[model samples]
Target: MIRARVGARDAMRILTEVARANGQIFEALGVSKSSVSRKAASDQFLSRSESERILGLAKLIGQVQSMTNDAEADAPAWLATWMAEPVPALGGERPINLIGTMEGQTVVSNMLGHVLRGGFA
Candidate 1:
């Protein structure tokens, strides 16, 4: 579904930007930075699953930005902190550790929703 709306280059750009903002290497997302560059150069689309993961990450980033009332420029650091820090609601698991799977994304998203609604995350 995300692939229908987002091109590979755009997804890679977003992923790369997020990784840089988080002070992390692209491999943290399970793909090498060179692979993303190669795909961009070739105009190849990301796999459906990869697209989903990127989209999920983008959504989470957006939510964090909205919640913080911070400029987009400030969002990456905030998101990185939030993801890397352990969450009591998640049984002390860092949010980033669970974001690679759909179920985990749902859990993170739901927690954000609760936070937005003024409930404990």
Candidate 2:
């Protein structure tokens, strides 16, 4: 598992980067940004299951990227691992609380670095 700090903006940026990198995968897989947006707005996206899936995909991509040097090499693995960890304290709260991400703009920078470079690693 990746061990580093990943904040809200970073997480969002990662998702966006993933979308951009594998937009075709999301499209072919039927995970549209619009759908994700709608779900997010309605507090429907990133359910525990969905969060798990997204994190799993993110980790896979990170792992693949880690194998190379496309960029985002310094991204925190804890961010992805956070998605897999359960939060009993958030009972009935947002399925995926990214408040932490919002607090860490550096993560955004990291994500931008990757997005700019294109793909994970």
Candidate 3:
């Protein structure tokens, strides 16, 4: 629930661990560093849009990781590297760059699905 803010911090932690990601990722996902820190310091909640985007980031990470089928120990670094790499299917845009918006997530997700189905990514 947005009212409680339970997902904000956890989502951030997930991004940090899985992608070695930071404020750039958060900002791209529409959460400013100052806002996250300020709300965290006050033990307050993120705005609905911020919480939604962060949660979406968390979900995207899970989806990517599942597609990888890599060992658990390898997943973090693998995801970080994969996210940074550019894809021709995305006009040479890095997956990480586009993952901030819902539309981009859809594109990335569909690309992964394509790869899973033995199509090019």
Candidate 4:
């Protein structure tokens, strides 16, 4: 991803399949839809930073799958639903709300860590 620019189609695949998000997800990640559209039309790659954010989101989803051991191959779908659900650890904020920035992504990752550890109780 850092070496060669990530393909716009690849990013879109991550957004739709892994993140189960709409185009607004690009806005949340600070990527412009017009830009993505143009790049997709031209078969070009996304900027490094744009690619990084997409990869980061995919990594977060992958973490859910890993932690759940695939959970009968439903972890990705489950993560999409779980991301929108509020969590007490986040002051009742939904996990999806904190995923727009790197720091927020870390917090979400940590929150998942807590859950994996039996809620830190």
Candidate of highest lDDT: 4
Where is model 4 more than 4 Å wrong at Cα?
A: 18-24
lDDT of each: 0.72, 0.42, 0.65, 0.73
Question: Distance (Å) between predicted and true CA of 28, model 3?
Answer: 2.2
lDDT of 3: 0.65
Query: For model 2, what is the alpha-carbon lDDT of residue 51?
Result: 46
lDDT of 1 at 53: 77
- List CA RMSD, all candidates: 2.6, 14.1, 2.8, 2.6
Encode model 4's per-residue lDDT on 1-121: one tens digit a residue. Answer: 6568789877767766634533346556777777877788889999887877777788877888888774577655666666777898788898777777888888888888788657841
Deviating ranges (above 4 Å) for candidate 3: 1-7, 18-23, 69-71, 74-76, 116-118
- What lDDT is reached at residue 78 by model 1? 62
lDDT ranking of the models: 4, 1, 3, 2
| True lDDT of residue 101, candidate 3 | 78
Query: Best to worst by TM-score, what's the order?
Result: 4, 1, 3, 2
Give all TM-scores, in the order shown: 0.78, 0.37, 0.74, 0.80
Instruction: Give one digit per residue, the lDDT tens place, for model 3 in 1-121.
Output: 5455544456546656753533357656666666666666676767776676666666666666687675564554554566677888888888778777788878877876676567876
Q: Spell out the clash pairs found in candidate 1.
A: none
Off by over 4 Å in 1: 3-5, 23-28, 116-121
